[model samples]
Target: WSEPRVWPLPNVWLGVSTENQKWADVRIPILLDTPAAVRFISAEPLLGPIDLWNVNGINAIEPDWIGGPTAGTGCPHP
Candidate 1:
Protein backbone atom coordinates (compact mmCIF):
# COMPACT_ATOMS: atom_id res chain seq x y z
CA TRP A 1 0.00 0.00 0.00
CA SER A 2 1.18 3.58 -0.78
CA GLU A 3 1.21 6.24 1.94
CA PRO A 4 -0.60 9.49 1.44
CA ARG A 5 1.36 12.73 1.46
CA VAL A 6 0.25 15.97 3.09
CA TRP A 7 0.41 19.25 1.26
CA PRO A 8 1.44 22.52 2.84
CA LEU A 9 -0.74 25.63 2.71
CA PRO A 10 0.15 29.31 2.85
CA ASN A 11 -0.20 31.26 6.05
CA VAL A 12 -1.79 34.26 4.37
CA TRP A 13 -5.24 33.51 3.03
CA LEU A 14 -5.57 36.69 1.01
CA GLY A 15 -5.49 37.14 -2.74
CA VAL A 16 -3.18 39.83 -4.13
CA SER A 17 -3.06 41.63 -7.44
CA THR A 18 -1.73 44.78 -9.11
CA GLU A 19 -4.43 45.14 -11.71
CA ASN A 20 -5.21 48.44 -13.38
CA GLN A 21 -8.65 50.03 -13.41
CA LYS A 22 -10.22 48.12 -16.27
CA TRP A 23 -8.94 44.74 -15.16
CA ALA A 24 -9.61 45.38 -11.52
CA ASP A 25 -13.10 46.59 -12.34
CA VAL A 26 -13.91 43.27 -13.94
CA ARG A 27 -11.97 40.89 -11.73
CA ILE A 28 -12.60 42.40 -8.32
CA PRO A 29 -16.17 41.19 -8.28
CA ILE A 30 -15.14 37.64 -8.94
CA LEU A 31 -12.49 37.71 -6.24
CA LEU A 32 -15.02 39.14 -3.84
CA ASP A 33 -17.41 36.29 -4.57
CA THR A 34 -14.70 33.71 -3.89
CA PRO A 35 -14.35 32.20 -0.42
CA ALA A 36 -11.17 33.75 0.94
CA ALA A 37 -10.19 34.64 4.48
CA VAL A 38 -8.89 37.98 3.18
CA ARG A 39 -8.63 39.98 -0.05
CA PHE A 40 -6.12 42.65 -1.09
CA ILE A 41 -5.40 44.97 -4.00
CA SER A 42 -2.19 46.82 -4.75
CA ALA A 43 -1.95 49.82 -7.01
CA GLU A 44 1.81 50.15 -6.68
CA PRO A 45 3.61 51.27 -9.81
CA LEU A 46 0.15 52.37 -10.80
CA LEU A 47 -0.25 53.54 -14.33
CA GLY A 48 -3.29 55.72 -13.74
CA PRO A 49 -6.01 56.74 -11.36
CA ILE A 50 -8.61 54.15 -10.39
CA ASP A 51 -12.08 55.23 -9.45
CA LEU A 52 -13.54 52.80 -6.95
CA TRP A 53 -16.35 55.14 -6.03
CA ASN A 54 -19.02 52.87 -7.49
CA VAL A 55 -17.43 49.41 -7.16
CA ASN A 56 -20.10 47.41 -5.32
CA GLY A 57 -17.65 44.62 -4.47
CA ILE A 58 -15.56 46.99 -2.41
CA ASN A 59 -18.68 48.24 -0.70
CA ALA A 60 -19.67 44.69 0.12
CA ILE A 61 -16.33 43.32 1.32
CA GLU A 62 -14.83 46.54 2.73
CA PRO A 63 -11.26 45.31 2.65
CA ASP A 64 -9.11 45.70 5.73
CA TRP A 65 -6.12 47.08 3.83
CA ILE A 66 -5.29 48.74 0.48
CA GLY A 67 -1.93 49.85 -0.93
CA GLY A 68 -0.80 52.10 -3.76
CA PRO A 69 1.46 54.95 -4.75
CA THR A 70 1.47 57.59 -2.05
CA ALA A 71 2.49 61.24 -1.90
CA GLY A 72 5.66 62.27 -3.81
CA THR A 73 5.33 59.17 -5.95
CA GLY A 74 3.71 61.31 -8.67
CA CYS A 75 0.72 58.98 -8.80
CA PRO A 76 -2.32 60.51 -7.23
CA HIS A 77 -5.97 59.49 -7.06
CA PRO A 78 -8.53 61.70 -8.58
Candidate 2:
Protein backbone atom coordinates (compact mmCIF):
# COMPACT_ATOMS: atom_id res chain seq x y z
CA TRP A 1 0.00 0.00 0.00
CA SER A 2 1.22 3.55 -0.76
CA GLU A 3 2.35 5.53 2.24
CA PRO A 4 0.78 8.85 3.27
CA ARG A 5 2.68 12.11 3.16
CA VAL A 6 4.66 13.02 6.23
CA TRP A 7 4.82 16.45 7.80
CA PRO A 8 7.40 19.00 6.52
CA LEU A 9 6.69 17.54 3.08
CA PRO A 10 3.40 18.26 1.38
CA ASN A 11 1.77 15.13 0.00
CA VAL A 12 -0.84 14.24 -2.66
CA TRP A 13 0.27 16.54 -5.43
CA LEU A 14 -1.50 15.78 -8.70
CA GLY A 15 -0.91 17.32 -12.12
CA VAL A 16 -4.13 19.05 -13.10
CA SER A 17 -3.45 19.04 -16.83
CA THR A 18 -2.29 15.45 -16.85
CA GLU A 19 -5.71 14.64 -18.21
CA ASN A 20 -8.51 16.90 -16.95
CA GLN A 21 -10.41 18.12 -13.90
CA LYS A 22 -11.64 14.55 -13.54
CA TRP A 23 -8.05 13.45 -13.11
CA ALA A 24 -7.49 15.75 -10.15
CA ASP A 25 -10.87 15.02 -8.57
CA VAL A 26 -10.61 11.24 -8.92
CA ARG A 27 -6.94 10.93 -8.02
CA ILE A 28 -6.76 13.48 -5.19
CA PRO A 29 -8.84 11.33 -2.86
CA ILE A 30 -6.86 8.23 -3.71
CA LEU A 31 -3.70 9.98 -2.62
CA LEU A 32 -5.35 11.36 0.51
CA ASP A 33 -7.01 8.02 1.21
CA THR A 34 -3.47 6.69 1.60
CA PRO A 35 -2.25 6.31 5.14
CA ALA A 36 -0.27 9.51 4.90
CA ALA A 37 0.32 12.02 7.67
CA VAL A 38 -0.43 15.22 5.77
CA ARG A 39 -2.16 15.17 2.41
CA PHE A 40 -2.63 18.09 -0.05
CA ILE A 41 -3.70 18.84 -3.58
CA SER A 42 -1.47 20.63 -6.11
CA ALA A 43 -4.29 21.63 -8.45
CA GLU A 44 -1.84 22.45 -11.15
CA PRO A 45 -2.88 23.15 -14.70
CA LEU A 46 -5.58 25.24 -13.11
CA LEU A 47 -7.81 25.45 -16.12
CA GLY A 48 -10.58 26.29 -13.67
CA PRO A 49 -11.55 25.93 -10.06
CA ILE A 50 -12.73 22.54 -8.78
CA ASP A 51 -14.83 21.16 -5.95
CA LEU A 52 -14.60 17.72 -4.36
CA TRP A 53 -17.12 15.71 -2.40
CA ASN A 54 -14.71 14.92 0.38
CA VAL A 55 -11.04 15.22 1.28
CA ASN A 56 -10.15 12.50 3.75
CA GLY A 57 -6.46 13.05 4.43
CA ILE A 58 -6.05 16.34 2.63
CA ASN A 59 -4.83 19.10 4.88
CA ALA A 60 -4.19 21.75 2.25
CA ILE A 61 -5.26 22.60 -1.27
CA GLU A 62 -2.72 24.67 -3.15
CA PRO A 63 -3.81 27.13 -5.80
CA ASP A 64 -2.89 26.81 -9.47
CA TRP A 65 0.63 25.47 -9.19
CA ILE A 66 0.61 23.84 -12.63
CA GLY A 67 -0.98 24.73 -15.97
CA GLY A 68 -0.76 24.95 -19.77
CA PRO A 69 -2.32 22.79 -22.49
CA THR A 70 0.34 20.09 -22.39
CA ALA A 71 1.58 20.81 -18.87
CA GLY A 72 2.68 17.48 -17.42
CA THR A 73 3.42 15.63 -20.65
CA GLY A 74 6.32 13.40 -19.74
CA CYS A 75 7.75 12.08 -23.06
CA PRO A 76 6.55 14.99 -25.18
CA HIS A 77 5.33 14.67 -28.78
CA PRO A 78 7.74 11.96 -29.79
Candidate 3:
Protein backbone atom coordinates (compact mmCIF):
# COMPACT_ATOMS: atom_id res chain seq x y z
CA TRP A 1 0.00 0.00 0.00
CA SER A 2 1.08 3.52 -0.65
CA GLU A 3 1.40 6.00 2.20
CA PRO A 4 -0.90 8.96 2.36
CA ARG A 5 0.36 12.06 0.68
CA VAL A 6 -0.92 14.20 3.49
CA TRP A 7 -0.30 13.78 7.18
CA PRO A 8 -1.97 15.75 9.98
CA LEU A 9 0.87 15.34 12.46
CA PRO A 10 3.42 18.12 12.76
CA ASN A 11 6.15 15.59 12.11
CA VAL A 12 5.99 12.49 9.97
CA TRP A 13 7.81 9.25 10.76
CA LEU A 14 9.15 6.81 8.22
CA GLY A 15 10.84 3.55 9.08
CA VAL A 16 12.81 0.76 7.49
CA SER A 17 13.72 -2.64 8.87
CA THR A 18 17.28 -3.28 10.03
CA GLU A 19 17.10 -6.75 11.44
CA ASN A 20 20.52 -7.61 10.08
CA GLN A 21 23.54 -5.90 8.59
CA LYS A 22 22.58 -7.13 5.15
CA TRP A 23 18.98 -6.05 5.53
CA ALA A 24 20.01 -2.63 6.75
CA ASP A 25 22.45 -2.34 3.88
CA VAL A 26 19.67 -2.95 1.38
CA ARG A 27 17.11 -0.65 2.99
CA ILE A 28 19.33 2.31 3.91
CA PRO A 29 19.41 3.63 0.39
CA ILE A 30 15.62 3.72 0.14
CA LEU A 31 15.45 5.53 3.50
CA LEU A 32 17.95 8.10 2.31
CA ASP A 33 15.82 8.92 -0.71
CA THR A 34 12.48 9.06 1.10
CA PRO A 35 11.38 12.27 2.80
CA ALA A 36 10.30 12.30 6.41
CA ALA A 37 10.33 14.63 9.42
CA VAL A 38 12.11 11.84 11.23
CA ARG A 39 13.47 8.75 9.55
CA PHE A 40 13.85 5.62 11.65
CA ILE A 41 14.73 1.94 11.53
CA SER A 42 13.33 -1.04 13.39
CA ALA A 43 16.39 -2.88 14.60
CA GLU A 44 14.36 -5.55 16.29
CA PRO A 45 15.77 -9.05 16.38
CA LEU A 46 19.08 -7.52 15.52
CA LEU A 47 21.15 -10.41 14.19
CA GLY A 48 24.44 -8.56 13.98
CA PRO A 49 26.13 -5.21 14.40
CA ILE A 50 25.17 -2.52 11.94
CA ASP A 51 28.03 -0.43 10.67
CA LEU A 52 26.51 2.70 9.19
CA TRP A 53 30.10 3.80 8.66
CA ASN A 54 30.32 1.85 5.44
CA VAL A 55 27.90 0.46 2.86
CA ASN A 56 27.79 0.62 -0.90
CA GLY A 57 26.01 3.81 -2.05
CA ILE A 58 25.34 4.62 1.58
CA ASN A 59 25.19 8.43 1.89
CA ALA A 60 25.75 9.15 5.56
CA ILE A 61 22.18 8.06 6.11
CA GLU A 62 21.26 8.51 9.73
CA PRO A 63 18.07 7.43 11.42
CA ASP A 64 16.30 9.83 13.73
CA TRP A 65 15.36 6.89 15.92
CA ILE A 66 16.09 3.18 16.13
CA GLY A 67 14.00 0.75 18.14
CA GLY A 68 14.29 -2.71 19.56
CA PRO A 69 16.34 -5.88 19.43
CA THR A 70 13.00 -7.39 20.56
CA ALA A 71 14.69 -10.74 20.94
CA GLY A 72 15.16 -10.21 24.68
CA THR A 73 18.86 -10.59 24.12
CA GLY A 74 19.63 -7.19 25.61
CA CYS A 75 18.78 -3.55 25.47
CA PRO A 76 18.87 -2.42 21.87
CA HIS A 77 17.64 1.00 22.78
CA PRO A 78 19.00 3.55 25.22
Best candidate, lDDT-wise? Answer: 3
Clashing pairs in 1: none
Model 1 TM-score is 0.49
Off by over 4 Å in 3: 1-10, 54-78
RMSD of each: 7.0, 9.8, 7.6
Worst 10 residues of 1 by lDDT: 57-66
Candidates 1 and 2 compared: the better one by lDDT is 2
lDDT of 2 by residue, 1-78 (tens): 399845445543432232345676678657755655556666555554455545455666655534467554422221
lDDT values for all models: 0.51, 0.52, 0.60
Candidates sorted on TM-score, descending? 3, 1, 2
Q: Backbone clashes per model, in order?
A: 0, 4, 0
> Which structure is stronger by TM-score: 1 or 2?
1
TM-score of each: 0.49, 0.48, 0.55
Question: Model 1 over residues 1-78: C-alpha lDDT tens digits?
Answer: 297633223344554444357766776778678655446565544555556666543322222233544443424533
Q: Which lDDT tens digits does candidate 3 get at residues 17-54?
A: 67667888798889767766666666655666676655
Q: Quote the lDDT for 52 in model 2.
A: 50
Per-residue error (Å), model 2, residue 41: 0.4
